[model samples]
Target: MAHRAASGWPGVTAALAGRLAKLDLYHPRDLLLHLPLRYEDETRLTPIAAAQPGFAAQVEGEVAACEVSLRPRRQLVVRVRDASGTLVARWLHFYPAQQKLLASGRRVRLFGEVRAGFFGAEMVHPRVRAVSAEDGLPEALTPVYPTTAGVAQTTLRRLIDHALASQPLEDHLPDDLRRTLGLPAFADALRLLHHPPPDVPASVLEDRQHPAWRRIKFEELLAQQISLRRAYLARRAKTAPAMAGSGRLVRALVDALPFALTGAQRRAWAEISADLALPHPMQRLLMGDVGSGKTIVAALAMLQAVDAGWQAALMAPTEILAEQHWQKLAAWLAPLGLEVAWLSGSRAKRARAAELARLASGELRLVVGTHALIEDPVMLPRLGLAVVDEQHRFGVRQRLALREKGGAGAISPHLLMMSATPIPRTLAMSHYADLDVSVLDELPPGRSPVRTKLVSEARRDEVIARLRAACLAGRQAYWVCPLIEESETLQLQAAQKTYAALCEALPELRIGLLHGRLKAADKSATMAAFAAGELHLLVATTVIEVGVDVPNASLMVIEHAERFGLAQLHQLRGRVGRGSAESVCILLYAQPLSPAGRARLKVIYEHSDGFAIAREDLRIRGPGEFVGARQSGLPLLRYADLEADADLLEAARQVADTLLRDHPSAAAALMARWLGGREGLLRA
Candidate 1:
């Protein structure tokens, strides 16, 4: 049977249908799901005498006198009075129609901010509409929705009202489940949220903690939980060859390491090894702060795969990161008589061909490259394990492509993803519920902490002198410009200008410049020089934010640090302090910082813990942009607030698990309703 169209709703016209379609509201339920952004309390009007300044107020009164004044500026002034006192309302720019509407003795309703004036209480440019005594006021708070250019607020409200009256809503939550959770029925919650009671405080509505709001939030969260749970279950049903191997290569690599793995590393590795031993492919997230030794864990996993007589491939997001991995892995693996191949878009044709041949014939036990590894030309015949480092840089499709290289008719390769940014517990539970999580919470022994300081631009010369002093002492320094933006030419010019200034400022020292605009080989060569201590000061952009590691580099100066996000700054700081030397990251911010920027800088200056910084970043940037870097496959939330509703999210996760286990049919309804368009992505 064909589904009925929302246009069929009573009083909905073709033109209105087109507008509604833009918002993806094709069903009455969609309208119901479109919750209001805020509410206007018009239940009663405040008397002009009792109105307080700096507070938004609504008033109803009769217009006693009105006139247009043109002194200093053209203005419309009207005196309105009720049983109490009178207030003066003014509009700097007014239409002739407005003047006629506020004629003498006319009754009007006004809503706007109240301000103290020379004569009395005043309202400037207030929202005014003509009214009659017979016109009734709204008995409850009026909902204000998010609307597009074509749709008017009144039209949306009426349509929603029609939906509520005509469309039948069923409670999907079980009766006992609702009682257990202390949640109201779904329909009742929507009605209460859309048209809150007159007694409901605006603070309650704004906080979104009212019982009605909680009901809606929990429902939305449960829908997401169900989708993720289903995906997790489906992946387990697929075939994946187990790569449990003898501890030959792992033991060899462990023995080669100069330092011991932290306890957290050992526990995380045990979890990963157990997962790889399972019949299902491992889709695990390896999260840790910078310098937490996630790379070592990944290396161990790859060696284990090779030990099992299958090829392993590691994919990085950038060529710089890939080259670093290749260099590090090559030194370790070559001693064990294993051929580690390197592939990247920047590789010369001859080197590429040789690696390709070795990769096809399975001569190379391990290969590390950038996205170039997933190109159609590069083939991995006996691939058993795929590791994605800095996993946030790649999308889900790209990750899936690397895993697909395991080829058809063969078991998919076990996948392990590594991230340097620590994800908060709430985000991990909801967004990464599909993947098992293993956190490397402890930094390796002998790693020094990076001390962060916020400095004003006026101290640029002092900072430069410090850099020179550090270089003279045989330590290297990194001078990072802001990350390039939409205008590549302008961004490059800025970095080039900064590099030139630094060169002039320190004529005796060797300085190098690096950015995305440089050629692939040139970038590699430049980075190699810096890593080898050939360059005393390396000036670059955010391209150096990830995967650029140097132990001897103890000083970092970030220009315009206020322009960067907390997470990005944290990543950049992570670049230093990898060695035994104590490092200092000086944040150079411009003058007149925004409140948010100042807060971010202060937070970075005080806290070095990545998990705490991540939570603060989430609170500042919100959940939408926080997880954007990682194509974690988590859908955007509409009604749930990740920060404010953390407790509710936990409850919802439990409810989702229960529903899936006990009431499959009701769970299906909930998922279908909330995740209508994204259902296919959840399916394996």
Candidate 2:
């Protein structure tokens, strides 16, 4: 087949080409990949009398009468009659050209939702296409596409038809592979999914489980798997100075800690230690429950690097978290004579310069900072280990940049990405496929579980009384509102208003307000006051969800808790219960909760395990909304449903591995077809 110029197509004008460009469809191959959203069964026509009300119906009939009426707010009414009965197609707004097309005696096909109106069996503004005597009706379902504002469905279809007719598509899937999977050829699959033969059941096409769709989906999943595998290979190809440690610093730190390490913590630390000792830079993810002492494991890894005469740096997402880590690390390491330096956006210029200088000289054995550590000026010449805390908050590029901080020649800094949010096994396997994973599944000892309860807004007074009593008992509490300020769209309480209300309700107790809109200094002061037990109650927003760790704050009252995701609710609840004192998390939800909201609250209330909550979140909110997917830049799966296509995904992974091993060239072609320009980035 010879290719045809898209501009030479019957309906494709320069303007149409420009519009198609907006859709990123340039070459014939791009147009071929533009799969339809759905197909409408227009092959068989429904008689006017048999048309179901409020259901889409397609009918072909000769126009018996056509006229524009001014009485009913100026509508063009076309009456068409077939063998069964007559139906009226009404359009409230129409151009004079449309009236010329709708003249009487003209055969036309009408498709739209039929409804009972003043005129019985009427279709309001139905899709109207003229039918000629020589025109043959389509023998298969009509494809409905996602189009831009300027491009119409008919014009798009014509352009696609031209492209398909002229372009010769090469099937990239190996013949054996296709036969083993029971899949159609690449070109054949494209044609089947686009046109879809009349014999193909509508339900199968709708679910996108037809052989054609599955084949395309497998190709996509294979591309992703291939890219991830290539990334792992590429990173491993580079040389990294082996961080073999004498276990001196690690042993000393473990002995110095007040509490003994849990079995899970010890295992996770062992894994990290082993990875760091490898010749290749360690690309690993450390996931743990909210209070699961992942920090200790990270500390052990950093200390191991320091023991090997290499510098280590830890980067956090927020300045508060960076400062929090610095405070804890400085307190722990200062006594051991290991210098720790801090850098953040809020750090003074002089202090930041000093820290950078110290890092460059390798005088700073352990460095803690926010994104400032990744900036060009802040160089760590001997950086052997780079720890990214709350890894989900940073992008892929940021993580790679931190890895490039040190190591001469091709060597790169070892990376240990840490997250307090526990990820479900399914998500971890797919999203973190390229990296090794270590999970800290157990919490530290003496950390009691936070008792969760749901409270109603109707009992606001009782809740206020309880909070006041809790405060008066020499304990601190947190009142978390969903919004920083009053939102006109939402009826949830604002942090500012809630703070004022709490002050008035409990005049004897000290209260502080914290939200994102507050100045950095003010926010830090408020958090400091709350942490020092100066403020009995702290009214805040979700900003405190991750880093504001006050152990004395035993009671957490989350207002309008229904609006938060399961992970967020769990994190907010984690802020409390850090102390030995008994802690309670009170979820105050608005009445008449939606099904999803009710389910989220119930999951949070019943389950204390972050991993279980993560799985439940994956089930309720789905893959797209899952924290792992949203944060990890997981490739968008067009036909592969994360839940329904789990088995297919596994098969694709195996196939990808085999193809890459046996036929590298074929794997490359597959990656080119699916990943396009993104293939290079994945290699990076």
Candidate 3:
């Protein structure tokens, strides 16, 4: 029976379809693209004497003896013999049917890794199938596919083979382009990948270095580039308010700053300003190292919107960071006769209502808050710009909701995303291709360099002593713990326990505690006390990893630092070193460090550059985890390795632009095949 690409298999039952859904196989076309994770060789057989231990080989023999042995455990043991020698096959866990299949005098073919067992050479739970002497060896290696729990490898292979036979495998790229790029034909590549010849070097295919693999990777990347580039073009076609604000507010804020803007900051602002003045909605990402003065640039951009008689809003991921931004922006703008409203979930009901009312009426042009800003009650009728701080901390839908707040009567607000975590180049090229990027590479003048030290848990006492010394000398310090509460499984230090211990260790110094569970009022009081120099030391969790900044706080001690990620460690260290005084970050790690833990700590200790540390983090954790692909709403590359296939990525990028401009139909077809309607998520 003929099966359509979207109709799925003809005889698949509901139960079978449910299992296929778990592997994301909804139609026949999906099975065609379900490439093998690895392949097993079964094209030839080896004699018992020629079989090598620790290597997988196919061997044929007749079962001389079969028995259920209970000596070591319940198992099925079968002894097979050939003209050359004898081999034993054992199954620790077996069924009655399997035992009958291996009955005495039956000819069988075994495929598995041979091992040196106590009795003799053995194969553990190998693929045992009854065969006749007339049966011939296969012509090609068998394909093994990634399958779900209910779906067996053999079942998947059968379904995919059927799809390959039924589905149309046509090349979308023009012939000249494919030949110029030295890529193989589309149909040939898929057929070869599914059933490779016996002579093919397994290493090249396994490592994805073969020509067929290249074609697959290139096509996958091309689809991604086309999706992002098309999203960019689609966004430009939409209309937005042209926020060409007079330079009055921008100049006043710039002149009022204590220090001049760095060259990198100036360049970033110029690019942003130019985008804001355009008729199309601006989607730009402002990336800077920790403590590189990103907030001021955001303030200037917001003022540009306000100067054009439009409302502006900023959203942060957490309450603490939002409050920090609100405080700073208020302090900077209040002196210039502008009122900034703060909105948060924990605010008093009456106060939140008042802010929401003002926002909806356009009386409040500038507001900063957490996710509460995106709630249904809050509205910004004339919002011309929306800025999201630490944008990766938010999910795609949250950011989209904030943008929709300004979508009134065919007018959409421009968006500016700010991230303290530096994105590596390869990631920026693939994941963030839809957004224009501006980087603030320079730190402001007078920012002291922070010295990082790695200390073993045995030296905890020394680190505490150093902390006490620094605090007694009128310098504040932060003690960062990994968990807010006790976790018996992790055994890491908790903030409350560390707070009580530090208070007992140093009675003369005033200390404070902060964590996420605390009430909003209490958290604010504790943070305020620490920032105002009322507390000499503060014990906190990773809640303070990003926005809490105090110049007087010149020392930081991170307990169980090995448990923290590279980006978190860097942000926590940035809390200090804001003042002229020399700052030092002490990483207190436990014993028996893992290899990955050691690598992370080493990267943080050796490099103070955020970009350099980010590159290393990408290498260690890969692009998906490093940038939070789920939060960004961008599908990751399934076949292409950003580092290994960078050349192919560049080639795909160039081809994507050409396809979009000259061959729009081909571009759309490619996106449909690979992305499968998931490209809509990139609109946000």
Candidate 4:
């Protein structure tokens, strides 16, 4: 706790040495946002006679003897005497110096798994420690915190305790404000949330239902809404020339359409056209669940940009997707006399140089590539539109990186982002507040629903045999593996091993393997083979979840399906049923599935609605790992759950909108100061 120099932390300061401390908070906002992972209130003190396997209990015993061993791993065995008998206390993965402590013969508290050994009752590799008389952990319901490598749970608890006890408390609601809102002071609210008694007040326990919570939710929402409104209004000042699609470009493509554009596609088309008519740069999110035909929407958008006599670009996250998009668009658009170019890591140096020169010379109409598109050296003569696929994977930095490639010119190119992942309302406000959203909720008519079934590992072989039969009948199937490779410690399962076994079991069928480690060219090659009927069954990692279309692939066999998230499973299922085939998705799970996993499977089995799955996914998993911190770049909320504070978000948006509209300079000043910056200094 002593204030001193911390490595690479020059400006940071710490509390005094003797001060009770809060956990070394990783993210200041996280403390406020660190919603509970799970609450454990199942602990019960048990006598030595009643100690048994599969139970979490608190036990006190007299220290009888202590010894050390190093047979498997370094260990210290402490013999403790209970009322019924003596028990061996096992501790593993400790300092070698701890041997001196074992000889001291001191009583200690033990926690972890309790298993009956060959000779007697024992705690195998139990997490043990000396208990302090005034330890802060609750006797019945201790909260286990997440920590970094050097940070222990105990250390985190201490820091949190200090923060709770000594930090300057904010009375968010003063006496006057409290009376107006019928709310308690900020300190009281924090205490109520962090250390509530058993008989918690109804208001504190269910903040979602509380009037104060509604006020807060409104505050958050209003701020976001206001900010977006300001940006939107400012952008509206400029006018864009509408380049309506003429049959000159669409005639060849329309004639080539094997299938007519769905009604939903037409709606999306109209929406994009309206955005193009505006003078301002288009900043819109094309949100469509998997198989909702967003790709066609993008193609139409690109054609409009090309029609304006301005070059357009499409950026993808990986080479596989980039190439896939290039081929599909090229087949349709190129036949209409539109020139297209491809660039990625796999492209040869000379070929890349040619593409770059073409881009710089304004010869290429549309180009597709991975992060390679955003390379600083790349030149775009007149970039009219930039369409990003799987928009969630690319964050602010990646998008900014691409924007720079348009050059230090008079104006930045328009942006059209497409995402299959359906974000919930709460998340849309906090995460994508800047971008306007358009949802492709309707599917093309006559698209048959995919039949989904949940099968256990015991039936895995049967499922595989069924897939073999289907493939033999000249049908294609996807065999998805869980992990990239095997691990000795997971105790779970792996995909590569499964792939090898399936290859051996189905020798007559063409089997292909695809995972992350493979080079982009190789992965794309395998995928092309599967699409072209060279491979009947594909054994792959989750690399194909985003947008690898194979209409002939009528069966999706996702092994160890319980391990994947709901959104991901839906995307994989989408890879099939794209063609005229009546597709079936088989989810193979291991025995004794977790309740949460069961719920996930049940939702998918009973329904195939992507948006519903997404909402439930958000509700079940909370916010974390849903959009993911890395992808959304949203700060975790501790005291505020976006889900719980929807009203606050709406209110915050309104305030931001009004302030910015009426007084831009003043609003910017307030934002700069609030963000810890001098007025007119920070651009954002």
C-alpha local distance difference test of each model: 0.87, 0.83, 0.90, 0.69
Tens digit of per-residue lDDT, candidate 1, span 1-684: 133366566777888877887787877778888888888888888998999999988999999999998876889999999999999999998899999999999999998899999888999999899999899888779888998878988889998988887777789899988998899998898898888888998778877888988988999999989999988888888777677899898999999998899999999999998888788878899999988988889999998888888888999998888888889888888888887899988788998998898888888879999999999988888888899998877887888889877653558788999999899888887777778999988888778899988889998999999999999999999999875567888778989999999999999998999998899889988998998999999999888989898999999999999988999999999999999998999999998999998999989999999999999998888877888823655567887888788888889889988999999999999987887766554311
Which is better, 2 or 4, measured by TM-score?
2
TM-score of 4: 0.72
Model 3 residue 92 distance off true place after TM-score fit, in angstroms: 1.0
Among the numbered candidates, top TM-score falls to 3
lDDT of 4 by residue, 375-426 (tens): 7668986787888898778876787667556652756667788889888887
| TM-score: model 1 vs. ground truth | 0.93
Runs in model 4 with CA error above 4 Å?
A: 1-256, 484-496, 659-684
**TM-scores of the candidates in the order shown:** 0.93, 0.93, 0.97, 0.72
Clashing pairs in 2: none
Task: Give the Cα error of residue 628 in candidate 4, in Å.
Answer: 2.2
Clashing pairs in model 3?
A: none
| Between candidates 1 and 3, the TM-score winner | 3
Question: What RMSD does model 4 have?
Answer: 8.0
Ranking by lDDT: 3, 1, 2, 4
- Number of the top-ranking candidate, with lDDT as the measure: 3
